[model samples]
Target: MQVLTITTPWFSRAQEICAKKKFDQVWIEIVHNDLEETFLEWVASLSPIRIGMITESLTYSSDVHEKEPTLEERKHKVERRLKYMTHALVCDEKDVGYLKTSSRVLAMWWTPAVPKRFIKRQRKLASLPYGIFIGSVYGERSKIIQNPELKELMIHQQSPEHGTPYPFFFDKMHGALYHFLKSRLPGTKLLFLFYLHFLRAIRQRCFSLWLEALQNGCAVICLPHYVKTYTGRVVEGMAAHMPVITPDIPDRPRNRALFEDGVEILLYPENDPIYLANHIRRILSDPGFSQRIVEKACRKINNFHTCEKRVQQILNWVETGEEPVYA
Candidate 1:
């Protein structure tokens, strides 16, 4: 009955979910320095046995708040925390990676489960293009934008306005709205549309950028590398019927398409931006080719391994302590 949830001292959906299931105790694991006792106190208010698992690592003290931790400092801290947890729930690869190396309790990504009705809703919603990507970008890790060709396709123009979230979000929104309205407007100039789309990319987040790009002229989306392992942004994008351009990474055992390469997803040769761009242009130019891709994507989305069916698997994991079966 003693269960522990070890996470950065931030607000966690996993912690709330675990609490709703009534775990006997929930612990928030944090680094030793620059620790917030208030977060621990909040957890204590939620559960009787809340505890803080502080690692032996020297993180930035509040006095050194402006400084970020060195790579070595982070590794040592993570290693120490790995040794501290006996039974724990984890939400990211870093946590899973740590668990794999340590003798700590088994870890789970604690991914969100889709409701049955939501699956049906998503199926209906899938016929239209819908794209979304949440969470901050760690430096140099965006799969699509990092590619020279993909970046050329995705980011039309750069904004000198950096860092502030409000300006970025608003600028993107205005640009998208202008382009969206222009496309519908009876004599909207092509040059005007191009200008709007370029400005949009500079201001919007990843998903919004995707939307704006599609509005201007793009037709396909590459698989987002952002989501954790078990979750499939590819499936979601496919379900929405956007022809997807994905990388052929051998390590990705779960997303291997059972169908032919072009029919399922146009899997490009490893990191060949020219090949990727060529395939992208092919799909955009050929209507029949694009439809086939959309059909295949929708087919894959409808088949087994949907979010709705995964709920039972998640529940089974909570109740019976087993890894959910992948269909």
Candidate 2:
């Protein structure tokens, strides 16, 4: 009947769902400092039926120098919290099997709505020479930037407030559009206009930078982590009608079902920058192929992954105590 969620940037999607459902009570605890204590006390007082969001502990299978919490400790935290709640919702599907608790585990994906204004503005400007990377630089991303084959491929790396340091190559090469342009064009005057549009998106907070990239770029390049979790940017790209290229994520059933190779998306094997670059080139060279991919992806997101549909499915499960089947 009521829902309580922690205030985190990632949890905004869950909060939107709560607002749409018009739940009896929606309490959000501001996580300014001491997240654990603030969250624990709020949950104890409210004792809500379904706790929708929580931050996942950072863990690595390999040995690391940092003093990270052990897997058992993280499980204990979940078990402690589950005592007062009927069901726990996690954004990542990998956690569903990792938690291994008695309480019902609802695997929810982050579904961010694409504004109609952005859709209307898409591809209005002349396509730029470069692609865009919106997230942090790490893992496969670091490797992709370093690959020699992709040297001429310009990527505007938009680093978040809390992200790993940019590699030296990226730092050196990233500058004005004219600086990176191998040759000047007759339409060189329009480069500043395109840059201004990018700056406006960041200033106005109209849509995410990646969505803006989908609007301006020839194609969207997403290098997801090796983990099986679904990236919300992929859906945002589809909604913007941009052809997306990313690594294969076959471990999770929901993701495997949602995307098909060369149909809804183009999937490459992990750690293959050569193949990734080739995929990018293919999409750029062939207009008909790119159009087909985006059309299929847009239809899928409209019918299946909209925020309204996701909220209704969650409500159905809460009321009927049965999982809603996904097609």
Candidate 3:
């Protein structure tokens, strides 16, 4: 089968999957930070599978926006291109409604290089002296960081501690620019191309989100996902064998059940920081509990969330037309 993936910035591990799948026929479209797109079409009449995926939405959730020139301006165009793809593979299941065909990769999926020895080491250090929550602070998650326990450990991209990025909070002028660009940019979208160049020139820096994510791989975050993206933050945490605590989404019973309530992950209500705090205290005080949760979570990722395994999922989805059955 000719498998084509139209994705945003590609990862080294994920890029390797193409070589393993089908070498020559794969088409990868690069969209700019959810900001814009570069397009491609089939050189042939038939192509078996075309996947539209943006892992940066999960992997590089923090700094991607700082580098992103204008998401507000480019989102419609970028999203339209993704909508055009044969299969739209979103990192989270909630985003399915917006696209034509959607497949959820589930659980902040990522290509992890975690060593078994590291997990063993973590098991020994089951007190889990340190904890962290890194990434964008979207929705009520801002409130999550305010908890005295989480507040200290929270490392938000928008926070001054890292670097202040003026990404999501756009004004009316920017909004007008988006409307004008979408409506006025015509034909090959020459104006749009120029805009990307201008945007990149001003925004370019030594910022590397993938590197940062790699550096801070051991992070614990739990929240009610209000938006479309659920990054690989959860996977990153588990890869390092850290215990996870987060709010369970009411709609996704399967996701809630992915881990045992206290075994694999600790679930808390969205607005309740007291519950979140209580879970953390329990883990910190109970070394056995933390080890059990971390071990099981790491084992689950080893079985299901690898890059090779995720790619294989799309192939199954295309063949069977059934929801991904996470075991």
Q: For this target, which candidate reaches the highest lDDT against the unseen true structure?
A: 2
What's the lDDT of the predicted structure labeled candidate 1? 0.47
lDDT of 2 by residue, 254-279 (tens): 65666788888988776787887788
Per-residue alpha-carbon lDDT of candidate 3 for residues 43-100, written as tens digits (9 for 90 to 100): 1122444545544332223444465545444545556565445555554444454343
Model 1 regions lying over 4 Å from their true place: 1-98, 108-218, 223-233, 255-260, 302-308
> Relative to the unseen true structure, what is the C-alpha lDDT of residue 182 in candidate 3, on a scale of 0 to 100?
52
For each candidate, what is the lDDT? 0.47, 0.56, 0.50
Per-residue lDDT of 1-327 in model 1, one digit per residue for the tens?
343323232132324434455544555555443433454444555644432333222222343333344645664654555443444444343455456566545554343232222222222222222222322444323554466665545443222233446576666655675565546544334434454465445534444433333322334444423323333445544544566666564444443533357786777654466776777668656868877877765665556445565545544554577865443
TM-score of 3: 0.57
Alpha-carbon lDDT of model 3:
0.50
57 in model 3: Cα distance from truth in Å? 9.6
Give the CA lDDT, 0 to 100, for residue 251 in model 3.
Answer: 56
- Regarding lDDT, does 2 or 3 come out ahead? 2
